[model samples]
Target: MVSRRQLIGAGAALVGAAAWSRTSAMGLPEAPTMDSAATQVPPVPSQGPHYNPVVTLNGWSLPFRMNNGVKEFHLVAEPVEREMGEGMTAYLWGYNGQSPGPTIECVEGDRVRIFVSNKLPEHTTVHWHGMILPCGMDGVTGLTQPPIPSGKTFVYEFDAKKSGTFMYHPHGDEMVQMAMGMMGFFVIHPKDPNFMPVDRDFVFLLSAYDIDPGTYVPRVMEMTDFNLWAINSRVFPDVAPLVVRKDDRVRIRVGNLTMTNHPIHMHGYDFEVTCTDGGWVRPEARWPEVTIDIPVGAMRAYEFDAVYEGDWALHCHKSHHTMNAMGHEIPTFIGMDKTKVAKKIRQVQPDYMPMGTKGMADMAEMSMPLPDNTIPMMTGWGQFGSLEMGGMFTVVKVREGIEKGSYEDPGEYRHPPGTVAYEWTGALPEAPSAPAGSADGSSLRPAGKSASAAQADHSGHE
Candidate 1:
């Protein structure tokens, strides 16, 4: 006795449910929009000629500006929603509001001072990631200092000690916070500066996300099956394509803060791992690696001398992390053809089959009940160790330019094709509270014994 409209609506709901299920299966949400005011923050000053100011992301600030005397520069980062399809909402932590955050350009050795203000309720801190700095300025809460509580401000002051691609992110409760999308890139130029730089330099802050809306609590990682991964906060196709000209010296700054070590593979040329967390390593440390293995809590700098130009897939070595999960939300059939629709209906719910299922084609019209036990153990093979962390990974597209081939178009080309990019989603989980025993559990000690006994038991653990 179902009316035609009711039947059609039910079908649409089914489809929507299916899509949502798939997104869930992927361990990520369908692209999110800037939902809570907790995620939003004030804007940074534009990077213009003769003037550059310190900036903040998600609440952490650092020193920014050029010392090499470069006249023109651009600093862009913003918050943006990850688009799933049309109406779906997926939010991410981004620079200028974009996932990978913004690409910051400055001369090497410049005295940089950036002021960061946190808008999110959770405590957050910004780690220079791979940049070398004094122990006090390293940004590690307790280690370097204390956590920057919510709604507070902190300033990161340091010299751009070396020239290479670097990054920034929250060091506290990194596993959770980073997985939620709080990370970005920091680029330092060489003092002399090589004008031979390519027509474009792209920075990509790679990461992963566990998007089960049911598992949104901070600190506690739901051991759910994660299937969705992204480059600059986007899956393939949805993510803007990287465009580039031939023969340009493309510099890619990649940082891996996810729990896993991303062995980033490039298509065309061999790249040099020019720098590490301690700044420029000795010549012996510099080596040519095609697929550079960037461990979690670390960064890698590489420059590719662009030779040929074509579209190539740059992604993490982990197979499962690349695609969306099998069940994010409920599946939808809004755009499917009639025949396919009939087949799907029969496959999913044959009992509801009817002679004419045409109107029920669009899955957008329906809403199905979400499933239970969807959350899975977030820890496994690639879980515990810093490098194998689930979320951090990205892509870099190296393209040909006028130097190697024909000049097609001409413009400011601020963001050249194949340029690396990312957006920050939000704060990660807070670190686990101190374990039982020690003064505040903040200090490490043996179990089952008093702090003094544990301390006396073993000094090696510390």
Candidate 2:
């Protein structure tokens, strides 16, 4: 067993190496003993046509190999370069090749043999969150089992008896490793999926990071001030949308590993909370809602029928969560007088300008310079204008005709003429005067207009 003191030292060394890896531009350090044989881990065999796997955004499904009757999987834990968006990337420790790792899918009642190879500089262990397994395979380092040291591998074999959405992450030195973005989703499909079959299934994990603008690695210690919120370790414009045909049943499974809860809202449809990490929520127990809040270290699965054909939004309801690289301490300048201050400041610095004086809506249009590898606080484009969003935001494009198993971008939606909102511009009706037998002295006038204007209009009508 590795000592706690040794683990801490090893973690510091790995973090230092990550910083070095960023400056060298050599990318992440190569995992030790990484070769063609090591990279070529056995693949998971297909479970026939009945099994429909979900497509993880900016992620992939893990493959396994069947030995005798048990399914075996090998996961390589190492440093990874995860793209947060188009321009921003982070140095993170994740399973396989990407952050949030890869989706592990299997059928209930099947025995699973998962081999985890740790290539980081620290000791780690994989804890299967919310899974029913024997005490020996629980994966609690220092308790249920020993931790896997640097460059070492460990195997966890168990029989997946329950079917539901689940998650996995490091149980040894959890705070540091998990904050470094080491996590993945484990999905056990029902033995009979046809009983609750859906045409489209999507899975993603909700995670938050505190990487300051212009920096790469996340500050593992800074838990309260997370600036970047993401789904599957990606922000908007880069996060993939869910595309489905009209009238298709869609099930979206979301697992949260962040510090705060997220109320995920979907536009244009009402969905039911069909499942949780524990198990499926019965039809009688389920309730319809437009938004569902998922607490930290929990999972929520939403199901609905895509009856509307258009581009709709899916995002966290918290206003700040939909933004990226946010500065929480910025002074609010709403209704403030900055004209005199700006003029004097411009004399000394030509580029000096006061921003957010009125509001932040206009800032989206300005092409202000940004850091070398940073994105705007809110960055997304649409036909109307800037989306003014960044994290945990994406569109659900429901089209008229889409192939059953095809996963292609449906392109921008074309709105029907009457569906879009437009300004009222036909004609205005004459203002009405007060009734003859009025108890109180009042007149019918537009809400913000003065009484004098109402009198003038009444005189004109007379």
Candidate 3:
């Protein structure tokens, strides 16, 4: 088992390496490196994906915002634990260190330069899913260029040629890596900015996870049984709600990069399919599409005039992947039990009882009474039924006005705060005194006695 201490050390090392790579690639001063290093600092155990280091690609000198400035961003990836089966752990990739990376927003025609530093061991590259860019700048490992080796840096420079929703992810080992959670959203605004004006916009990157607990790794591309589907890197309720005000025109950029296609169904008013990967479709092409089927490696942009005021559910229509493998309570046959089963059911279903049966049962129990705890048997009715059909869905709440402490009108939508909540109370206190004797630890403390004593002495100052 990997100890918590080792995990923390690994996470710190990864962050430090990523920071160095970004600084080197973009030639930016170490100062004012988007406070993502401060705000979305990795946890001790560092659950989920390590934040893909962010690089400012504005010319040779990287541009950054000052404290609390409007043009600032904290880009990080979220690490996620995908249950391929029971007792297994496969770390999925994410932005802000999350499975679904952060949503990057900018205006069309804006000169955008993004520095991408690989943190994982494998070579990876970020393909600007739908955005049109110079052939050389397009991020295809072998097609456009070689893979960005681990610890190395690559600068993605391009002009936001067209305005619409786009996505980014590793193109190398795509099937496996993407399935494990290497995806995020990229939005570009129009230069003139006229269309169906909107109060708020959200991005959804639909994905699937096949967790096999017995192995601690996510089951990627398993042909037999497909399980666990998600929108924006989470299963239903865990997916987070998009809050909006009534009458607010909201735009949603949906991207599907999984091997399978996702027919995303949104409730309430019908949405207009304004754009596709090929760019803005003709007005004649625009149509009311309630459920849009986003094929792999494709993106769709739509605008919905929020009218109804209520909580709407969004999810995948595929039944099997919607909920954990059907809370089946069947027991596993192992060792002597396996022998007994083999003896009796040799003809019925060979090896029907495998090793992690109990764990599978446990997952079924955990996934039951899907989101809101009100709907039971996610595969049968309501949201559950939608999910079972492999329809990746999420809810849009159209309220009257902007909630308190928010910028837009009440109808303008934003994700609920609890979406990214963390339990910090149980974490090890910020390395009291820092690990003693090490150069880094000593540097963290005043140039004096041991780090421990210095920490204690400086406690009051803090």
Instruction: Give the per-residue lDDT of model 3 (tens digit) for 1-462.
Output: 222133335645323434444555555323212212111212211212212222111100122222111222333223444422222234776444345555565666666667676667678888888778899888888999888887676767777778776777877888777777877767666666465456665566676655542333567776435455656544543444566766777767677877787777777668889888777778787999787888878988788877877666655555455564233454554222455655677678664443453333333233432232122223322322233322244456677756522322233234466753467777585555655557664545656588678777778678
Show the lowest summed lDDT stretch of 10 residues, model 2: 33-42
Over all chains combined, what TM-score does candidate 2 have?
0.84
Give the top-scoring candidate (lDDT).
2
- Candidate 3: which stretches are off by over 4 Å? 1-26, 29-90, 213-216, 221-224, 326-393, 404-462
Global lDDT of each candidate: 0.50, 0.80, 0.55
TM-scores, one per candidate: 0.55, 0.84, 0.59
Cα lDDT of model 2 by residue, 1-462, tens digit? 222123224644222333333533542222222111011111223342236677676566665545556766677888887888878889889976678787788888889888888889999999999999998888899999989999888889999898899999988989988999999999888888676788888888999999987899999998788999998888887888888889999999999999999999999999999999999999999999999999999999999998999999999999999988898899899999999999999999989768887789766777788887678887788988898888999999999889876668888999988999888898988887668545656577777877789778888999
Clashes within 3 Å, all models in order: 104, 3, 61
**At residue 184, what lDDT does model 3 achieve?**
70
Better of 2 and 3 by lDDT: 2
RMSD of each: 22.3, 9.8, 25.8
Candidate scoring better on TM-score of 2 and 3: 2
